[model samples]
Target: MLRVSIAQISPDGTKEENADKVEALIRMARGADLIVFPEYSLGARLEHADRLAEPVDGPLIRRLAAAARESGLAVIMGILESAEGGPYNSVVLMANGDAIVAHRKILLFDALGSIESRYVRPGNMPLTLVRLGEFTVGLATCFELRFPEIFRSLAAAGADLFVVPAAWYAGNLKEEQWLVSAASRAMENVAYLVAADSAARAFVGRSLVVNPWGHVELDLGKGERLVAWEISRDAVDEARSALPLIEMANQHMGTWARVRRIY
Candidate 1:
């Protein structure tokens, strides 16, 4: 079993404040095997994101790596990655004081009048899957959750757990959408889904963890909090055996071969 902790925090405009929150959460979740933070947890506002950008190996990430090593817990968090064209909203997975995997946001939020594309560059990288303890984990950022194809691809790549770091905006029925989408993904793929969302003022604060059976194991409501839950590969296996969706899909690949070719 892998013990996971989710840190839901409202990061301000300063990197120092965000780093302090991460350190505090790490100390609080002392025995967890992995801890995840929300997207843009390094403090980047849409208007002035350039000022908050940092290289992958910048001081902020280095401090996070050191903290992960010291706490003996793997850390997954999002930050603004300084790049050639523009900053990419990316997430890094840190273990043993080093970054093992990084994923840039493929689906930028350009539909909500937020104009994320104006400040951040879109990424075209492949899905990142890494071994974390007994689980093969897949990483995805905020807007990527709306795309089911990404989750399907990760499942095909043998991911047992999907860790999503999101800074989901709060408006309309967005809260309901977040929960439904998370549960749907977990059930469809028969995999555990762990989503850590920001509790920032304008964003939704309900961070959640869904089991392979589509059961909500942990949900941190609209406030800053740290929640921990136990996840096991056995649960994933059991869910798959019960549903048999993935197994059937694999067995009947020829059915979709023509569709894939056409698409």
Candidate 2:
């Protein structure tokens, strides 16, 4: 079993303030094997993303790495990244005092009164997976959760857990969509899904953790919260053994490939 803590906090336009909050949360998350923070945890608003964007090796990431190393815990959180074309919505996984992997947001949230493409560049990089103490964790950010294909690809690459750091926008049925998508991704991939979302007014704060069987082990409402739970590898094995969905998919992948080529 892997002990994990999720920190759901509202991020403002102040990076230092947000960093302080992250430090406080890490202090509260003592003894956890893995700690997660919501997207925009580095304090980048949509309109001001470009101004706040920083490189992966910037001060914020360095501070987070230091915290992870000091606490002896792996960390996952979202931030705006300065890139060649523009800023990118990105997430980084920190362990052993370094960034082991970083995933840029592929599916930018361009709808619902917000235009991410204007300030955020869409990434074309492949999915990233990292090992965290008996778990191979896949990384995704925000809108990527809406695309099951991304999750399927990660599962095919042997990810046992999916971590999503999101600043999901609030709207009609938005919260419901968040819950359903998280549960669906967990069940279909037969992997644990842990999503930490921002609690800001413009975003939904319903951070959640789902088991391989589609059970919501933990769910936080519209408030700032720090919660911890254990995820069992045995449970994942049991679910796959019982359902065999992934196994069946693997078996027929060749046939599907042939059909796709023929078409």
Model 1 C-alpha lDDT per residue in residues 54-130, reported as the tens digit of each score = 78787777887888899999999988888777888999888988974379998899987787999999876888998
Question: Over the stretch 83-110, how does candidate 2's per-residue lDDT look in tens digits?
Answer: 8778888887888888743798888888
Q: TM-scores, in order shown?
A: 0.95, 0.94
Record all residue pairs in model 1 with backbone atoms less than 3 Å apart, i.e. clashing. Answer: none
What is the alpha-carbon lDDT of model 1 when measured against the actual structure? 0.87
Model 1 residue runs over 4 Å out of place are 257-263
Lowest summed lDDT window (length 10), candidate 2? 254-263
Residue 168 accuracy (lDDT) in model 1: 95
lDDT of each: 0.87, 0.86
